[model samples]
Target: MSLKIEIHSFSYKKGGIPKDNSGNGGGFAFDCRGILNPGRVEEYKTQTGCDIGVQDYLETKTEMPKFLELVKSITSINIENYLDRGFENLQINFGCTGGQHRSVYAAEKTAEFIREKYPQATVFLQHDEQPQLNSSLINDR
Candidate 1:
């Protein structure tokens, strides 16, 4: 059996949390609001996490790296277990104030991490606030 991981970036203020459409009840929801928000800055207000400026701000000025390291550590174990147990679906969510900067960056990085580490799992990435960036990555091992 193949494992399908659904990762979403959303806003706590706007959408609350993303639902687990996979019918698995739900999964991990990591709050990115604690890490410094780039949305508060004027220069980065217009840019989403997909942009370099916001990405830089989250990477350097904030504790996002450490936060993500923890998230990765927690998720990696579950991914391995899911794969081992032949699970069908897993959902991971990242939420921030605006769902633009911190959450987006974290979601993107987490998706990349999963793709690189668990090549056998299929990943569905969605930016709830920025739908244009939505994509599905199918990695068959």
Candidate 2:
């Protein structure tokens, strides 16, 4: 069976939490508001989490690394179990104030992590506030 993981980044103020279209009904939703927002800074205001400066600010100035670590740990267990059981879909959502910085970074990092650690799973990444950045990477293992 093929396993597909959907990772979404959304804005709490704009779009709110992303809906799971996987039909599984239950999944993980991570709130990124506690972390320091790079958007608050003048230079990072125009940049999304996809930019190097925003990523650097999130990594160095915020607790995002630790938060992502925890998220990785929790999600890893579920991913492994889902793969073992031959599950088809898993949805994970990350939400921040604007969905451009912290949530986007978190979702991107989590997709990367899942792709690296679970080569058997296909990953679909979406930035709800930035539809142009959406992509799907199918890992045919």
Ten-residue stretch with the least lDDT total in model 1: 132-141
The regions of model 1 sitting more than 4 angstroms off are: 136-141
Candidate 2 lDDT, 40-135, residue by residue in tens: 999999899889999999999899999999999999999999999999999999999999999999998998899999888888888999876775
Q: Which stretches of candidate 2 lie over 4 Å from their true place?
A: 136-141
CA shift at 96, candidate 1, in angstroms? 0.2
Question: How do the residues 1-141 of candidate 1 rate in per-residue lDDT, one tens digit apiece?
Answer: 789998899999998899888888999999999999998999999899999999999899999999999999999999999999999999999999989899999999999899999888888888999987775534321
- The local lDDT score (0 to 100) that residue 69 gets in candidate 2 is 100
TM-scores for the candidates: 0.94, 0.94
What is candidate 2's TM-score against the reference?
0.94
> Cα lDDT of model 2 overall?
0.90
TM-score of 1: 0.94
Candidate 2 — which pairs collide? none
